[model samples]
Target: MNDFKQELIRYPAARITEVAKALSGDLRVRILETLGDMPMGVSQLAEALGVAQPTMTINIQILEQAGLVVSSPGANREKICYVTCKSILLELPVKTGDGLHRIEQIHMPIGMYSRSIVRPTCGMAGHDGVLIGSIDDPRAFYMPERTDASLLWFSGAGCLEYLFANPIPPGVPLDELRLTAELCSEAPSFDMNRQSDISLYMNDMPVGTWRSPGDFGDRKGKLTPDRWFSGTEYGALTEWKVTKDGGYVNGIRATGTTLGDLSLDYSEPIRVRLEVGKEAEFQGGLNLLGSGFGDHPQDIVMSFVRSIDRQ
Candidate 1:
């Protein structure tokens, strides 16, 4: 039990549609059911299920790419398949829209940060109530098990980036993009005097930087676990929105970067990074709080807004 692991795979609703396709066929489901017990070679699986090996291989490939299963070569070099995670969670929006709905939202876990360069006082906590690794160790931040983190915090200069999968269908131009999160300044245990300038970036382009008032320790966060005490607890639920007008944080104009400035209609995923660099004016560091450790109930939420007023 000393070795930590994550057995949950979460997907956005839009992307879930793609994954749902893999599970649509009965043959694929059967293959999955069989793989759940143990890993098997493609030929062995097909024979046991009384299906053609060629047909089985096709279905298995789809699940392998969706991260539902892992396939490898065996002694005879035949492909072996094994289910990856114990469970899969698909996050669906509360509402669906085709005409009136102009926004698409996706939540990215704090631990799923694709890139980072954190310094001392940095650490992460999994939902299980155990710290992933020793604090202040940048190497620990790269642990594969960090995906289970409910909260990721750090002191000093560093940046955490997430490659957000755009939900805006191809060929559709976006008029606005908004990112919302719960964050506060990092203090030794807890200090109201600490202030930090947190910057937001999209695909290496600077969106804006806002000054956090102080490290929050006012009271225990509603979702904070018993293991955490006297540390930064909660944060202001702020929204950084970039629209055709400009970039606005909490309804206050923070950056003039317009919607057109980002050219987000690309094939690659959207890159969003939150940073508090070493050279920052107020380098109080950052406490990027996620659900179960913050006042908020969710992690980083991104929404794509398409305005019909213009299009």
Candidate 2:
């Protein structure tokens, strides 16, 4: 449907039990199948499935909790549910012959940026989707409560920088470093046709730039709060990886910049910057999503993997 956003969802083994419990019931499975075609009200689903409205509501809540369904208020205050994920990818943990930690990860919240220089159409919202300060005010970014932001947007051109504490252990010999975040373009209300060129930098070294397809608001996000009816809903998950050979975006080489160019220092914090330069061909702006406001339930994540041989 034109009014829905669907994407594959990836989960780790730790969440397998919760996801499995949600799909264990036959009725819940049928509900997902039905919603796959269209969004439906609780009463509508109940009628189609030959069940009482209360029963349907209960099942819907279960699916919603598991992030399989997202619901919003429809006419007459009725709850309308939409399927949020096209598929699910479960990643099982690998067993290491020797007991040791080979990977280190850190999650950074959106509002925790060390510096933000944004233009108009800029603002941030807390995990509950409530505005932290006056919308479109650059000074709003400096608010003390901004640290709780789950969603942030800016127009024209600007940059958001973050400083993360180095997580690599001393003399670990890193093999690869990865950074991932949910992001998209920004538009008034929402425009599927909008596009934006966004760039990323690691420790002041240029990583690469990516073109965002559009500002998606057609449907609610799985983890997005129901109270948030803002035009922007969800974003695509973008990742930047650095290896000894070069820098890549989504596994495709984007630049000759190698991991060595990053000049990562274990004794210092890591700096990350996401920006839309004034010279960008597509100046549509940018929207960044955090754990409580996107289809993916994660914030800005950085993972450092140790060398295989050393592990």
Candidate 3:
């Protein structure tokens, strides 16, 4: 049998040793696992694992030095940390065939806020005018309808769908998929009582859901305009995730999904739909601001790519 170890040896010994050393310690492994889903502060990780803050800090530092972890400023001056690497590939006994290896990532790097002045009682619609509408008349300004809808509010349950001409190819092995967007609200306050649930879908299939704490329109001029300032306050910062098995929000797992999920084909016609509402009761609404809300809106971004890991 041909020795495949020789092929593996081609990788620098220092790099391999770094990867092994980072994985050798149980504490380091735990820290990496915790960061797999989302970024967390040292205090939160320590509290969750029932460990000392120093222990968590030490392990995280090691991981960071090894290039396995990344850190940034968190809410309220806390240092937030997240895993930078998702997977590792090991050389096997068999020689792999030569083929194309592609990795694609799409990001909608914009904040949410509205601009157009809609008349009171007048419904805000997208540039298309036939896509969808918001629940409340005043709230319509924030709906994800037009590329220009910078302001959006959702009370009870509401759904918005975006149409795209390019769809994903039918049979491509999918590696990892995620949908990230920034969200914040001013409402019942940033407490548990003031909460909102968000979900994503494709072809009517549920992708994932995230429950966010309301920001209780505490800070002035976050969502509502100075002129339209109503007494009702609510807010939240949220991220919704979807994978082959299922989905999650913040860091909690949500139900509904199966394995071998279809890979979205960007070359074909595609549509992405978002749903936001209260689980038991109408808690509050959401604000979506982008070029898509105006008379001449931009495209609602959707991305699809293939990888060898899935195969």
Query: lDDT of all the models against the reference?
Result: 0.80, 0.87, 0.50
lDDT of model 2, residue 293: 94
lDDT for model 3 comes to 0.50
Better of 1 and 2 by TM-score: 2
Among all windows of 10 consecutive residues in model 1, the one with the lowest summed lDDT is: 93-102
Displacement of residue 96 (Cα, Å) in model 1 is 15
lDDT, candidate 1, 1-311, per-residue tens: 21112378887654666688888989888888887757888989999899898888888889877778787668788887788777789877544433224677888888999888888788888765578888778889999988888877788678999998866655566777999999988877878878999989887777778888888887888888877764777887878888877888888888788877777765678889899977889988888878767788998999888755533
Poorest lDDT segment (10 consecutive residues) of candidate 2: 93-102
Pairwise TM-score winner, candidates 1 and 3: 1
For all predicted structures, in order, the TM-scores are: 0.67, 0.68, 0.44
**Candidate 2's residue-wise lDDT over 1-311, tens digit each?**
61554678887654666688999999999999988858999999999999999999999999998888998899999999998888898766454312224676899999999999998898899999898899889999999999999999998889999999876656557788899999999998889889999989998887888899999999998888999997899999999988898888888898888878887887899899999989999988899999999899999999887786854
Sorted on lDDT, best first, the list reads 2, 1, 3
Backbone clashes for every candidate come to: 0, 0, 42
lDDT of 3 by residue, 200-269 (tens): 6665567666555553444443334444333322233444445566765565667455334544455653
**Candidate with better lDDT, 1 vs 2:** 2
